[model samples]
Target: MSRTVFCRKYQKEMEGLDFPPMPGAKGQDIFENVSRQAWEEWQNQQTMLINEKHLSLMDPNNRKYLQAQMERFFNNEPFDKAEGYVPPEK
Candidate 1:
């Protein structure tokens, strides 16, 4: 998901926790960094799972599925087409 969306979702979850606000952090932006890190961790886990299972995530249908998810995360806007903006190859 987009950073903002992820942050909003995470912020909601975090509201149920007892974590204290970080010093000097913006209330609204509090979850952005943590959410981005979480997303990265999630991607790594997915990659590891695929590798361990010898899965072919490179299939055309798989590519489309991933693309759609990315688009959804991006608020349904077209994904970046600029060179070097491609999603993970796998």
Candidate 2:
């Protein structure tokens, strides 16, 4: 059976990640508090942000910006999105 966490983002108990999605204190915090579903949502958003903004992880500033956004995302705060992006409608 999978572990459950009180997801900070969804604000409810849900399935937790098998392991921390990353390293360090932030990753451990996320592993203990963020649900897998929320993490996946951030992954999608992160990918979009990277592509639209041409973010390079090699750049410290870019990585820092993404890290901040990730924190905001898990904390259920307003986070930046790719400007001018429109979801495809079916």
Top lDDT prediction, candidate number: 2
Per-residue lDDT tens digits for candidate 2, residues 1-90, read: 999999999999999999998899888999999999999999999999999999999999999999999999988789999899898999
Best by TM-score: 2
- Candidate 1, residues 1-90, lDDT tens digits: the string is 232333432443322212323345532233333355444544554455445445477687755655454434424344323233345777
- Please report, in order, the local distance difference test score of every candidate based on alpha carbons: 0.42, 0.94
Q: Model 2 off-target regions past 4 Å?
A: none
Could you tell me the lDDT of residue 53 within candidate 1? 46
Clashing residue pairs in candidate 2 (N, C-alpha, C atoms within 3 angstroms): none
TM-score versus the correct structure, for each prediction: 0.33, 0.93
Residue-pair clashes per prediction, in order, are 0, 0
Q: What does the lDDT read for residue 77 in candidate 2?
A: 88
